[model samples]
Target: MTITEYIQQRRMALAEQLLMTTQLEIKEVAIAVGYTSHSRFSSLF
Candidate 1:
C-alpha cells in the first residue's frame, strides 16, 4: 500500500481501539487520529 494508505489504516485502527477501550466522543477520537473534520473521519471510519 502507499504511505498515505498505510497511515490512514493505522489511524483508523487506533480510532477503533480508542472507541472500543475508551469513552471518548467520536469527534475527540477523530482529532486524536489527526483528522480535523468529523464528517471526513466518520466517512473513513
Candidate 2:
C-alpha cells in the first residue's frame, strides 16, 4: 500500500482501539495515530 493508505489503515486501527479499550482522550489518540489534531482524526474516523 501507499504511505497514505498505510497511515490511514493504522489510523483506523488506532481509532478502533481508542473506542474499544481505553479512556484516553481523542486528542491523545489522534497524536498516537500521527495526527496532531483531534479534529482531523475525528473527520477521518
Candidate 3:
C-alpha cells in the first residue's frame, strides 16, 4: 500500500479500538485519530 493508504488504515484501526473500548463520541474519535473534520472521518470510516 502507499504510505497514505497505510496511515489511513492504521488510524482507522485505532479509531475502531477507541470506539470499542471507550465512551468517546465519533467526532472525538475522529479528532483523536488526526482527522479535523468529523464529516470526512465519517465518510472514511
Model 2 lDDT per residue over 1-45, tens place: 899899799888977888689887888888877888889889988
Tens digit of per-residue lDDT, candidate 3, span 1-45 = 999999999999999999999999999999999999999999999
lDDT scores of the candidates, listed in order: 0.98, 0.85, 0.99
The order of the candidates by TM-score, greatest first, is 3, 1, 2
For model 3, the stretches where C-alpha displacement exceeds 4 angstroms are none
Query: Native-vs-model 3 lDDT?
Result: 0.99
Model 2 alpha-carbon drift over 4 Å, by segment: none
TM-score of 2: 0.76
The estimated TM-scores of all candidates read: 0.97, 0.76, 0.98
Instruction: Give one digit per residue, the lDDT tens place, for model 1 in 2-26.
Output: 9999999999999999999999999
Residue pair clashes in candidate 2: none
Which 10-residue window in model 1 sums to the lowest lDDT? 36-45
Candidate 3's clash total is 0
Clashing pairs in model 3? none
Who is ahead in lDDT, 2 or 3? 3
Runs in model 1 lying further than 4 Å from the true structure: none
